[model samples]
Target: MTSRALLRFSSCESLNFPSTMQHAAVISCVFISSLLHTGQFALIETKETVWAAVGDQASLSCRLTEDKDVLQITWQKVLPNGEKNLATYTKKFGSRVSAGLEEKMDFQYESLQSCSMVIRKVMEEDEGCYRCLFNTYPNGALIGWTCLKLYVLPTELHGPFITISRSNSPPGSVVTCSATGRPVPMVTLTVLHQNLSFSHYNTSRVSNTNGTVTSTTTALLSALSSTQVECSVLVQTAAFRELLVTVPGLTDSSDGLDEDFESDDKDERWLVTVAMGLLVVFLCGAFGVLSMLWFKKKHQNR
Candidate 1:
């Protein structure tokens, strides 16, 4: 109904009430009528922030507080430069996604009063704020905003490559271990064998363009009594990788001597094989010469 007609009706109703009650009754009627006319009760509810890991699906939803005859709901992504419409849902048209975002974004749930959008295989570029616009008759549009944050956690830990360099000063070996992961993984060194002594040398970090960090740590080993050292690469308490390395000069001297003796034995066997081969060749030649001589004597006797 028209505002003027409603006000007239409120005045007529208020005439039956007492002075103090009439004012309150009229005010209530006018407020209720105004709310009905403006459709201001159509508010949307949504989460403030949604977080998801990269390559995972991120779902964003919006629901109207009060039921309304909504025509359509448009989902938009808020960018630093401007906002871009990603998808839309309507009863008549169903769901439609933007051209480039068709593979990445789509409507998960479609309704006039409530809707949700899903981003498949979420990437770093997909991290941003989004808004859902509810289009209603007479009310224009109601908007609700939600922001997305993408996190990249190390999934499969690769390696803790260890390299050793012998140092003359103080008579120790310098051990270096490195690993690459997202969010800067931590590298640590420990001596696994007993009687092994080591001290911290230094650590360095490098950032890559692909959003990964390489961490390297160096340590000085004091004693040669221990042979085994370990390197641990960790992103957090949840994810970790470990590698074991053998110190070159710290192994038993007997093992080296045995290896050398084995090598010498192999060389002796090879020399024997060559010598036997030569003896076979000489014997074959002698047999051929003796056969030729016997055949010549038989021919001369014939």
Candidate 2:
């Protein structure tokens, strides 16, 4: 072991042994794990993935091992294209957190031993891999990595989008409800009245040109005396949105109206056919009389 390591290990024996012993034990484990790196020694405990919902807060914490004099702590984010420097904090310079992220992060314990950050109102862009680094005096640097996944909640999930139209052929109604969200929401349909039943249904999901997803559900109702139905959407982020569709006629049914229009067209065609037959008979009688008159005048001349 180097002199710094020997001094650090011996100092724990002189100080509060219980608390200092914990640091020594963690430091010894890190040193053994880094036989290739020699003097660089630091370890932190945290999860590899953090799941959060849009418009909600998330936290990433890191606790260093046997770190007394921490020079700087840095947080970085890795995206598909490249890496972005998120924030940085130094004991002497205070904090140099990013512009928009200043109000979103909490830097209460900005030191070398413990570096923690809070993400406020997580958004879709926040989903990515994050790296936390601690630069200490003789130990060099310690790094810990984590990833974030942010889910979007359903939006504008209300109003005429939820509708019920009366069934013309059958003695029931067809109910359709559509909701939009990211991470594709899971939609469920339920009739309000106790005795109502769902005979059959169809559901489809479409990916918009934008980043959002739209889900539409159609439910066939039989013996449905219910005045309303409910559509509940659940997102991956544990956030949910719900809307109720009053069975009150949202669409009109025009079944058999086209047959009435066809009947009227047939009656008009029959009237035109009868009028043409009468005109043809009148023209034939007039031509026969004129021929008779001409023949009589020729015989008189002879």
- Estimate every model's Cα lDDT from 0 to 1: 0.81, 0.71
- Compose the digit string of candidate 1's lDDT tens values, residues 1-302: 66654876667575888987887777777777777654543477888889888789999999999877788889998988988988988888889999988888878774587889999999988888999988988778888888988766775455789988767675667899999887678899988867666786689998888878889999888664547889998876447889998876634433565899999999999999999999999999999999999999999999
lDDT, residue 6, model 2: 65
Once fitted onto the true fold, the runs of candidate 2 whose alpha carbons sit more than 4 angstroms away are 1-42, 155-183, 186-204, 207-234, 239-302
Alpha-carbon TM-score of each model against the true structure:
0.44, 0.43
Tens digits of lDDT, candidate 2, 34-108: 563343433666678888877899888777766456788888888778667778888678878888878877665
Q: Against the correct fold, how does model 2 do in TM-score?
A: 0.43
